[model samples]
Target: MQLDLTTFILEVLNFLVLVWLLKRFLYKPVLSVLDARQQRIQGEMRKAAVLQEDAARLKQQYEARLADWNTEREIAKQSLEQELARERDTGMKAIQQSLADEEAKNRVRAASAIATREAELVRNATSGAYRNAAAMLRRMASPAMTLAILNILLDDLASLSEKRQEELHKAAHPENVTTMEVVAAHALEESAQRKLGDAVAKVCGKPLQATFKTDTSLIAGLRISLGESVLHANLADELGYFRSQDKNV
Candidate 1:
């Protein structure tokens, strides 16, 4: 409570000096530290904002990439499905074609077998018919029948067409002196032989002479021979000719 000017002034001066020292050393350093901290916090906040924007962009890119991958996968699946379908169809067609070919071959084989069987049956029937007719003719042989057939044969030779006559002339070689033989189932009378020789000479267009022979196995009729050529109207010759024709059929 004592009003001392010097003490009061000194106390005031000392207080002022203390406040100045604190401001220069402690308050200024504390304020600088606080400012640096504020600046660092603001910089961190800005960096965080930039990072968030980049994260958003990355998320969008990832989603777009996923969508593109899904689309590609779907396209690939469709292509594979189409390929498989094509392969299956091709396989089915191949199998069907093979079956058709096999069926056609079977039909051809069956038809050929049937035709062969029919031809064999026809051959057997024709052969039997030829044998039966030959047997029947052999049982009915006679000397009178033989003479009649010989006369008919000479008549047939006389009445031959020009073309057939020429063929006979060539075969008989009447111009060439050759041995000609006339065979019969029965021996002819002298008058009949002379008449037959005259008739044969007239057909030959040359002086013709023949040697006659008898063979009972001829059944009936006559056979005339010149070298390898034999003209006959005998049952055996007729049967043999018909047998050849039947075999050809």
Candidate 2:
């Protein structure tokens, strides 16, 4: 405790100089390092937040795209199935129509062939019928050939002069008659009528009075009457009789 002012003042000056030197150099360097570290930590936190937001947005976009693709594929498959069904229906219809057309054509051809065959058969049948009838008439009429000679009797009477007309009439019968008649196809200008008449008249022994027709369908001939014998001696009936006769011969 001796009073020393010079020493005390020197110690005080030395302490002030040390504090100023540490603030200007060591203090400023330490504070700079601490500030840099704090800034780095804040920047890292902000970056992490941005990355999380970006990941969420990408996930949502991919899900929406997948849904749209699935819907498009289903629509395409439906359209293809519909097209196949339509094509099958059209093909089946075409095949059925073709079969129907062919059937119609075959029916027409079959009908034509049958008609032609029937016509040929009819024609042949008609021709053969006519020939047989004509021959039958010639055979049966042989006796009637005498009637052909009777036509010459008129000439004999004429040559004898008018006086012979009365003489021949008186010689044969009390009456001289003239008559005409129609006959059937069977008796037609055919000798059968005269031959039959001559044969029949021979029994009665009546003077032969006659005219002949190959046609015998006539209801009567020469105005002659018998007990009950009527001959079918009509004019046009000759056509049917001859048609029938021709086939057998």
Candidate 3:
């Protein structure tokens, strides 16, 4: 099975021509299909990675925004609480001041009213006392008092000297009684005047002159005169006489 050199060379050349034709047509087309599939898969993987990174950034931003909102809410709540407390304190203080002012005003009014009432009562009491004094004085020293004085004088006559009695008789004679007059007015009724005249006669041992004269300033009483010596027995004069008598008694 040994071949000749020229025939072996021709067979080798034909085999080389077949391999070149298969590589150019079938092998190159199949390799190109596989490379295109690999490139498409790599592009899809790259797009997925980029989307994941964007999602992470968005989640962080949302968390930050929520925390800022919570802080703002807390600050607003504290501010509202402070404002409410201030308002409450102010209102309570105002109410207390108003109450104190009202109480002061009420006390002042009560004191004023009391003062007015006291003044009115004092006036009424004083007026009543003055009226009572005037009336009592007029009654206590009148014809009745004059009669009593005359009786006392008569009783003392027995003890007096004859010379002194004579002197008294000359001064109080019936002839001297002409100028003497007893004080009287509407205050001295007819009965009072008659009693006064009797008393005067007994004291002087003579008939006395009596007259009804209205001197309203004497208020309400009698005045007796015998010569220059007068007994001004007026309503106002009675109090001194009674007080003197009380001291003696």
Better of 1 and 3 by TM-score: 1
Give the per-residue lDDT digits (tens) of candidate 2, residues 163-191.
Answer: 54444344334343322232333332445
Q: Which tens-of-lDDT digit does each residue in 110-164 have in candidate 3?
A: 7777866765565555446555776665555455544454445445544656676
**Model 2 CA deviation exceeding 4 Å by range:** 1-48, 94-187, 190-249
TM-score, cand. 2: 0.33
Candidate 3 residue pairs that clash: none
Q: Report the C-alpha lDDT of model 1 over 1-249, residue by residue, as the tens digit.
A: 689999999999999999999999999999999999999998898898899899999999999999999999999999999899899889888888888888888888887777677767776776677667666767778888888887787788778888877766676564564657888888887877887777766666654678999987687887888655678878877877887886677
lDDT of 3 at 19: 79
Candidate 1: pairs in clash: none
**TM-score per model over all chains:** 0.63, 0.33, 0.36
Any idea how many clashes model 2 has? Answer: 26
Sequence-dependent TM-score of model 1: 0.63
What shift in Å separates residue 91 of candidate 1 from its native position after superposition? 4.6
- Give per-candidate clash totals: 0, 26, 0
Compared to the true structure, candidate 3 yields what TM-score? 0.36
Model 1 has an lDDT value of 0.80
RMSD of 2: 16.0
Each prediction's Cα lDDT score?
Answer: 0.80, 0.50, 0.62
